[model samples]
Target: MRITRALGAALLTLGLAAAPAAADTPSPGPSDGKAPASAGTSFRTAAEIEQGQRATAGGSAGDYLYWSFPADTGQRPTVRATVKLPGTHAAETWRIDVYDGLRRRQSCQYGAQTRTAAAGASSVELACVLRTVRAWAEPWANDPLPGTYYIRLTAVGLPVLDRGLPVSAEVRVDAEDIGGPAAVDGSLAEPLVPGIATEDLADDDSRAVLFGLEPDDGWSSGWWSDRWVWTAAGGVLAALAGVAGYALTRGPGRPSRVPPGA
Candidate 1:
């Protein structure tokens, strides 16, 4: 009975220790109830917004608007955009594209990523539902991962007359947890959010100064892949096997002396 109780206690301790890892990854909480008033025109100038916060901006019809937000592992993020186009006689086509921190374009699982507004139409709505962010992924794969994601909205096709026409855009990002089943065994060593050095912005007064340009070396997750671990393990095994093979195939050592046995 004592042994059984001890075993049960050990099991309970282990379960308690493992509970946090097995629990569902939590979704990012609400923002500070503030909305972004403007958007950026380039990646270097992309406006940063939080989940559940909406951003509204006005720009020319053909201009590109960029916004970014943070996403966590096991969450599927969806970006919704509305373009209130200026009065035009020709149909206009608009698109919303999402990119991970690496600037690699992420494919939408499902949403009207690209839509064409009919001539005389007042507005066009676009959305891109990104794949669930994974805790870790192969180095070569562009799977969504926890990081800063960018949303770029622009008119893909429009008449020349509408090029300089005033237009308004609204963008919002929403993320939902995929729950515990989406959890993976491993996680990134660090999120893909780029670290900006404050020293670089001390002198400049431009918008780029506020939001520093991409690092001179460029953005990287610096994530150590499982492949490296497997490769190292394989190398160790190969060395061991070589050592064993040499020991087994090499000439036998001299036999023990019979004189000492007597």
Candidate 2:
């Protein structure tokens, strides 16, 4: 009876542990049909600094590394965002909201006007012209300790208009700026390239090694490169080099051979 009771208790404990995990596991799909994965817009890492050191402020010399901010506390700092709408949606209205790490509603702006598609096309270019529009709540003012927050953009009335289309840049906030809005003087590093796309973005290791950044695990660097394919290529090159080195060091000789049927 005691053994059965103990077994029951063990099973109960295991079930309890599994319950939280099942709840915690994130669902890969959207919550509802309201929003699907966005395919048009993209995310970029504007400015990121993994560690601090004294460098002449501004002018691209000591810019932050590439990464998104509000990683685990407070709100993310906002920077310039320029979006090119697809030449499909005729004239669309959109709203963008920035939230803290905890998914709480933060600062939001409505009616960032987007120009209509120029007659022949159905999309337009929209840029944030405001001199530092407030996108996130003051990092400190957040009820939940602010952390890496998400920038969500939605097109009102047009659920399919621009939802899930990822668009935004990561503006890293320094230790001092934690729980506070970024300073006007705070700035983002220059882009890796002029146009937006994976081709124009930086590689994860390359960006970190170059800019000196260390972001939280699982954070997308917003840079894309085919890692596995490149790795295989590198291995092939190394093998070829080894073969060449052996041939060169072996010295020319009429290759030694054993006597037939010795």
Candidate number of the best lDDT:
1
Q: In model 1, what is the error at residue 168, expressed in angstroms?
A: 0.5
List ranges where model 1 is wrong by over 4 Å. Answer: 1-29, 199-262
Query: Can you write out model 1's per-residue Cα lDDT over 1-262, one digit (the tens) per residue?
Result: 4335544555565555445543423445556657778999998678888777788999988888999887776678989999887666578889999998889999999999999999988999999999988888889998888778888999886789778888899998888866445656677876677644344354674322123322222222333223344345456556555665665666468565688658
Q: Against the true structure, what is each candidate's TM-score?
A: 0.67, 0.28
Give the Cα-based TM-score of candidate 2 against the true structure: 0.28
Question: C-alpha displacement of 197 in model 1, angstroms?
Answer: 3.2
Candidate 2's residue-wise lDDT over 19-65, tens digit each?
Answer: 55344322222112222112112234432223121111111111122
Worst 10 residues of 1 by lDDT: 208-217
Leading candidate by TM-score: 1
RMSD of each: 10.5, 22.9
